[model samples]
Target chain A: MLDKDIKKNESADNFVLRLFVAGASANSARAISNIRSICELYLKNRYELEIVDVYQQPLLAQQEQLIALPLLIKKNPLPERRMFGDMSDLKKVLKGLGINEVI
Target chain B: MDYSAKNKSKLNVLPKTPTGISGLDDITRGGLPQGRPTLICGGAGSGKTLMSLEFIINGATKYNEPGVFMAFEEKTEELILNVASLGFDLASLIKSKKVSLDYVYVDRNDMEETGQFDLDGVFIRLGYAIDQIGAKRVVLDTIENLFSDLTNESIVRAELRRLFQWLKDKGVTAIITGEKGDKLLTRRGLEEYVSDCVIFLDHRIVNQISTRLLRVVKYRGSTHGTNEYPFLIDSDGISVLPVTSLHMDDVATSERISTGITSLDSMLGGKGFFRGSSILISGTAGTGKTNIAATFASSICDRGEKCIYFSFEESANQIVRNMRSIGLDLQKHIDAGLLEICATRPTMFGLEMHLVDMHKKVTEIKPDAVIIDPITNLVTVGSVNDVKSMLIRLIDFLQRGQITVLFTALTINKSVAEQTYEAISSLVDAWLLLRDIEFNGERNRGVYLMKSRGMKHSNQIREFIITDNGLDLVDVYLGPDGVLTGSAREAQILKEHTGDVLKGYQKTRKDREILRKKKILEATILTLKAEFESVEEELNRTYTEELLTRNILEKNRKEITNIRGTSSENNTEENGPHIET
Candidate 1:
């Protein structure tokens, strides 16, 4: 069935990613850039990135139980992954996001 | 050059924000500094939040100053409801736009630890609240809540500094409360952030009595009282009774008023107590200390001046009943709206709280005279020096206000030099010592004015009788016995009656003896007069017989010639001669 194939393709190819950061901090900027580069380089047209400023939306950050700034959450995937602290390590980021070796 | 005078002159009198608490503003020499953050640090359950909330609540109601209360620990409803017991209608105040509450809920999970964290969000919220209500007072209760979940301490410190600086820059008087630290004034060291003023509240147990004490730890630019004053958290809120007078600058009066007992007044220089002076009546139990106080209060009320009587040992009705038996109709004074009886148990409150209650009542009622019956009852709450200092403050306060105050203390033993009198002897302007003198198988009440600072008082103890007619001094011993009291007085009256009966009997006997002597003398005089008359009659009879015999003889002899005429003449001459003899 073409419908089942389309659903499977949407789940596997289309990525939902969210980035939480404090306002205008250097670490927040670095985390934002690194996460953005990773998403754009790995899944250019396949990912949907949502950037949220924690200070501006503290309630939203609280709802997500955020303890640290410059945090990233991968949604819409089979298993969700959370990464924070030293996000500049590309290998660690890729390993936490569970990216395939082909990507 | 007087350097002390120069320094005193150079002192800067800072602008103050009134706390609007009874006796608190007086102790603070106005209040906390204006446009500055004052830190109120205390242990848990020490009433830190309640005190700060009272500041804001009093600001809104009394000073007409709108306030913003940003609670870091409790919700707005909880804070409002909790302070309602203090008669602070915060909900109504907020509803009327006089008070604004913003609970800054900081969930630790959302607040991450970092090297740099600005309290800009908090400042924005507080500033918004202040602007919305046009508030002039702010209270931030508990500053440690923001860092409860934070791992880094440096950021919390920096943010606290900025927060206080921003609050001061806003030109609003603020109060910041914090938990007391073991080694520091505050757990998070918030006292360092607030540089203008710092207040420390402590809840301590002295003699098993929980007493809340408050002191101004530091006030940078103003002269404030430095004594630890006991505060009360009752239905009325925190009221601190600071040292009443820093200097004895009272304008003493030389006018004297009676103690209602004429004899006692005579003992006190015949003019009674000095107006506006504190009188201490020290006596043993049942020596009539309360009677003395009741008489004094009754006299004050009779003079058209109001008097407040505080009876810690007896209820109002009990005092009235007891005083009635002493011929002091205190109920009439109460009915006339001139006498107020405030009766409570001494163990109900500590010395400071008791003093606060007195201050509140004094301020509210504004009586011309105050009577504290048995001031010794307060000794159970504190040490000797403590009660002494409390009385000193009380006396100073009443004297400075030109209000007459009387304190009755019970001396429990024969060693008056080492008992209650020793505690308040120096503070009282006049002291009257009442004692129970037992002599000749009788106990008589005697009162002596030991000292009247500005008047000459009698040192001799005068035995006084409290009869149904009132108290009177027995000027003399009567009825072949000594001065008597109670049934002894009645027995003396009966003895005098018997003596009068004996005097009457002796008087009648002497009258009877005089009557018998007068009767005997009258009988003797009558006998002598009767004897004289009888002798005169015998002489006349004898003379008559002789004249007759002479006439017969003359007749016989004159038979021969004119004998009858001659005999008749002879007889007449003889009769007249006999009568004369």
Candidate 2:
């Protein structure tokens, strides 16, 4: 993933990341914690994470157009990736983010 | 106007505060702008204070917008308690920090002695309260209470401008209530020009119906609803539902209810009446218009929906008793909170004021069906046009809430139930005509569905009897006399009697024909019997005579041998010839 990031950077591609978080409450705090953990384990230096707090920033939340809570976005990866609900499955989240190749 | 940043750009998309009023919000496109000062100007008891109080309380409770109310009339505590009767928890909301109410008193004696007053005290109090609560909404009820006297027009005018500017500069959405005067929007009229928005509250009597009309005269920098909305205040506070007008969308309901007569329902295309429609029942006195209205009201309640009956002629108790005699158990509904009876005379107050009070009462109860027993009594205070307009306004007020309304009107002329001198027919969604027809030497009460918008109803006039159990819609009277005038049942009996007599006469004629056929068969048998007897006798006599003749011939032969055998032979031949002749 890091090698791919280096190649993408060399190509001078702009990274666009997005994350839809339902209202900023305690439930969101726990979801954000799990999202950060997944980011560090699978795509440490490969993708940029866009954390969006729907509460306090409702318009931005609407712009991302999310219906559910605690969404994680990996915009830098040519195709955007989204994982909802605390990112419980590390393997699926990594595969969805396009970082790890699973057998 | 300031579009320099994305954050500021997003603010433009927010929907305005819709006060949930009847016609007013349609005029203002929801309600006043969110963080701007809206001046409500009206005359005394014109509902300026009531409007502001209702807006503030309703916003804090309904729209999730916490508000602060600063009153210049009455003590804060008294206002709280008074509004509490209408189901507004002002005191509790204040304790919860959802709403804060403060009263600033202005005394004429104090101002007269001082001779000098500044707007600083008001500014300080309002600023402290708004910041303390971080209030997004605020109401300053009745600016008239702030002034000791309006003798100096120049000072009052200047002060009004400064006050409006301060409210705008503070960036808090405020409603400044004021007293309306004949010359200007307010006594000073200065606040009308300076405020970002101006709303006028009116209370008037037209057609015996007292109504409150709220109109926004000015709204800067925004598209607003431009119709006069009818507002109601009750135990639940204030709600303004936009009335149906010629231009807006009015969704028609396909559901219906029976006129309690199958034949009548058939005339209406098998459907009964539209849901959430207004029906007007008009007839002369003794035509049973009220009875029909009561039955409908009861039927709706029986369907598990709530109904409200406003009787301007009878007392609540009297109406209940009268309806009971006609077989409707309205008392049970009243006990269950399904039916509310409000009986008041239109003459109790001026017409406009009466409408305002009625609006308030209806809002508090929130019934699914409303019955105004007879609007004619309200005409005692107004002209025909006034009554017509008042009814239009009232219908507009309730129908917007998706509430079904049944109204009764007394016909001044006994001839026509569908009134033409009054042009309210077009305003109603449906009409029911109850009439007394004089036929077969009796007067019978019959109800016919005149029109039911968007649904079918019984077009046939149904003869309904007020039985001990209530209004019994009998089978469509199909007798030769047609729908029996209330007493036409007697004519039916008389016709039955004549039919029976004719049947008896036909039976007697059939019996006589059978007797005559029996007599003719007996005469033919007697003649045949006599002929049979004579034939038998002749056969016997012939046998005997032959025997005797034979014996005499034997003797005569012996004598003939001596006398003449030819004499005996001649006698036998003569007997044969005589028979042939």
Candidate 3:
């Protein structure tokens, strides 16, 4: 019973995120920076974020059926969410993540 | 010679537009500058207009870059319809905003009557068209048509410089076509120095054969092909090939295609020529040079591969009919789009134009193989050096594309099948010699492979014949008479008769000797049998004598035994009396 509670706590603290970028274009670089800033400002202590360069790892990107670049995918915490665009708007991103409200 | 521009960064330069022509890109390394003026100069009927139109149409439709064509000579409708035969839909392209056609309408007659002229009006009209459609490419067809012969040379020179500068400043790739003269590059030589690139097109006839050629006279800031190339102009447009003259490693094929003759194929490593290679069939008139070339071409086309036949000495219909008489019908292939026939007299135009025409046709047809029925007919119009250079360029262009090119030459000597001139021999990859050999009261046609690159061909001459079906190369008739010379064959026949007579005499003598040996052996057997019978009789007589002597002795011994028994009985009775005493 103690082990189950510990596992739940660990799951809540760890977060898995992935992004698919088609090319080394200008927009792709901007999206990468914005996502990194959002994670550090609000969820730094509560969750862990992983950045993946899809151009370098095309095979993995293909496995996720990625069609365009600058795509953010929330892989952890059941019912995964995906957002595609410049990734600058934090409100729409939080809504996509099921946050219900932006802190 | 100039390195001052090297310090400037080139990272901001735009990517070049691909021309998409076969060998042009390879020669230019990629394509022409994306947004720069390129000058194309040539003489009358030298394909300047055709080449310019091809560039513009290709850029617009093929590359999706809008282009504007301003012809100072041909009308808009004539130019459009002319290129339409090449499968270029200029009308549709213009309607869709991809291409624009305009005619500058420059007439020397009008200029002579007016006595005053300026090219400013021409530039204004061209610039307006370019601006209206946002065209990235522009063509000035035959710019020389705008000039009058009596115009001041200094003014012409200045105007050319300004024209090139303005086009460059506009940042659009423009082609300014010119008319070549006997001495000067153009009526005015100013364009050659002012343009970043200068291309020269030539049309010449040699030995009644017309050829078209293209050469890069000058190219700044880049290396290009320096050799003259054969080109062709037909309904498909203009194509320039630098040929295989570029010094680079060429891959040779080991797999061979059948020559359609069993004996010939077996002699050539059990196959035939490499998939793509040039073959030279040379022989004197009536020595079957055309027959061999036609047979090879027809056989290749029969295999479902496309072939192009350029007959400089005969008409297309005539060649087809003549070949049909020999049982090779090429009309079926022509209808199937597998065989294309292009016939023309070399003297009808310049030798360089003939080359260009061939290049153009080959590109449009995209044939796997090409045949020049007799290249010798083309030698009449130019000097030996000119013909050699043109032929070299032609071969070079075909080799680069890996297109199999076959050329026929008429040798001087009836016995010799290849040209001993040494001009074209060194450049050819393979040479097939067809000769007439006289033997046995008849002149026989012998075919042999003199040399084939990367192939093991027969060194012996084989008798070849053209039959109802096609060429049939017979086996080498190596007889005991040493190559079957007339006198040697007769001597061999006489020697064979003598040999039979001598063999009969030896058999008779051997038969007599065997009969004599058989009689002697039979006599010896008879004597041995008699001696055995005599020995048997003597043994039997001796045995009978011994039997008689033994019988008498046995009778005497029986009487002695009976007397001994009586004595024993008497002794037994006496023994009892002695014991009592």
Candidate 4:
């Protein structure tokens, strides 16, 4: 799944992502696994991932303007994009971040 | 189909969390529904947020349950600072991990999410705040801030419902405050989503006095007080007063007190008032209401028991000074620590706030007697219904503590029909009425026992007077005409005294005249008797001489007969002449 905005501004090829969680919530755990599977299947050796526990780093969450939980933010893929919820829809999550196919 | 039984079988029994508020817990039977969201909806400055925070703080401190406070409006520091005066040390609580405060700033201009956005952002913040503190209680204060300037109402509404359900799923009792609306409990009508329990707070101005009230609109699975109770926000924080819970079944006492007047006590079945009973003295202006109240309060103090006087009309010093004129020194009791005078204006707060203050003072002082000087002034703060409700609560509370309560009400008219709010009169155990009886171009004070439950009282009207020595009650003058009092009674008594004196003088004059006439007649009769006796003595001497002459004649007749005849004739003539006279 490719996004036109990402295609136009392809300044970064590697993906930098941040996942926000609150104490191993079901959505947080599921979103964590979904992000891991998506990275392994599509971006593999090209992605860097970081998971933030808002319960521990609430100041960080506030500074980042995080409003929703289990949120996935793609930071290093040209333009940043955000997706909310458990990130279960692979195609939707990939398109939201402006990624094309599996590599 | 046995639907009733079937429904009962499926019905869920909800547990409660005591709010630790004074009257609230008793009214709620326990507290808010546990592990569920309770909605607190009210207008601005109605103590909604304060009450919500108090619930959480009390849970942490008193119930050993940690709490989380999430705000969509106020910042954490601002919230902390605002509550600092209420004796809530939020910062310390946070430091001790007993409380976690989170603020989610949802600025309308900045919150224009372009794509799919769930409220999970604030949700996660709140969830984290709760998890970090292991909070059993959660408070989302004024979450309506999220709906401000938002184009998406449906989504926001759904998110709020989901958030509440999620809190319930997490098994944390939560409080959600919402803004009151024109025709709905909440601005968005969120009362539908908050189904477990709904508390509505109301703040309004009546007769130019602001009053805050609380009502439990709905409470599932348990019975709750349904009246609109007055809630107060002061140094101690917000407290809901459960008014109108009239538990009239308290045991009646046989012990009595003086009615503050000796004659008045005799009127009240030879006693003053029953212990734990409520006495209401109602009168118009200048009927010695304050004097009676002062006497009652002073008497309680004199008994070595504490007395609290809520004087709406006079300050403590003013009462002390004024009562001195009547020869009652109340300051001595105050100095001795047996009396406390709380002088507050009736307009200072609403009715329920007054009740809450009284409750607080009573609990703090543990007074044996309480006097509210002129409770009718409370009508200025609220409607008749509100005042009645407040009085009921006060009477119930004081009775529960077995405190003898005396209340004075200033009335426009002394007639029962003219009393604007007589509901309080009905609630009292004894009622003493002080009236100004205008007669003979003079106004006089009269005291009458209107009613005293469970005790016999005098039906006669007694003249009530406040002298320099104290209260004095004199028997009303019941001349053949009607009852007389004051100067008229004095004049009647004076008139009767003059009439009695005049009658006694007339009776003595008549007795003297009779004695003088009798002496005159007795003197005349004695003179007449002396004259007659003299005549008779002369005649008897004559008769004896004649007899001697006759004897000589008779002897001489044997010797000289002619001499006898002449002597006898002369003697007879003398005797006859005496008899004739």
Instruction: Give the best candidate by DockQ.
Output: 4
In candidate 1, list every pair of residues with a backbone clash. none
Docking model 2 quality class: incorrect
lDDT of 2 by residue, B1-581 (tens): 34557675667653466554444566776677766778888766777777777777777777777777877677888988888787777888898787878766543321111122234335555666677677778888766654544344555556667776777677767888878878888875646545568888887665455566677778877766566765655455555544434543555566676544344456667755666788888887888888878887788788888888899988889878998887788899889889888888778765554566667767878888788878777667776666677777677777677778888888867333234324778878778777777776677777777787776455567765677876655544567645555545655767788888888888887777767667666776777777877897898789888886776676556555644644555566444323321
Candidate 4 scores an fnat of 0.21
Q: Which stretches of candidate 3 lie over 4 Å from their true place?
A: A1-103, B1-32, B44-47, B70-127, B140-166, B177-193, B202-213, B269-271, B281-372, B381-408, B414-422, B428-432, B447-449, B452-458, B461-481, B485-581
Quality of candidate 1 docking, DockQ: 0.13
DockQ of each: 0.13, 0.01, 0.00, 0.16
lDDT of 4 by residue, B80-129 (tens): 99999999998999999999888776444322233334566676667677
Candidate closest to the true structure, highest lDDT? 4
Compute the TM-score of each model's chain A versus the native chain A and list the values: 0.82, 0.67, 0.75, 0.82
The residue-by-residue lDDT of candidate 4 on A1-103, one tens digit each, is 2244434444577777777777677767888888899888887887777787877776666566566566777766645676666787777787877767764
| Chain B structural similarity (TM-score) per candidate | 0.84, 0.73, 0.67, 0.84
For every candidate, give the share of true A-B contacts it also has: 0.00, 0.00, 0.00, 0.21
Distance from true location, Cα of B240 in model 4, Å: 1.2
lDDT score, candidate 3, position A41:
73
- List the candidates' TM-scores in order: 0.80, 0.64, 0.59, 0.78
Give the interface RMSD values of the models in order: 7.0, 27.7, 28.3, 5.0
> Given candidate 1, what's the lDDT at residue A95?
72
Q: What is the DockQ of candidate 2?
A: 0.01
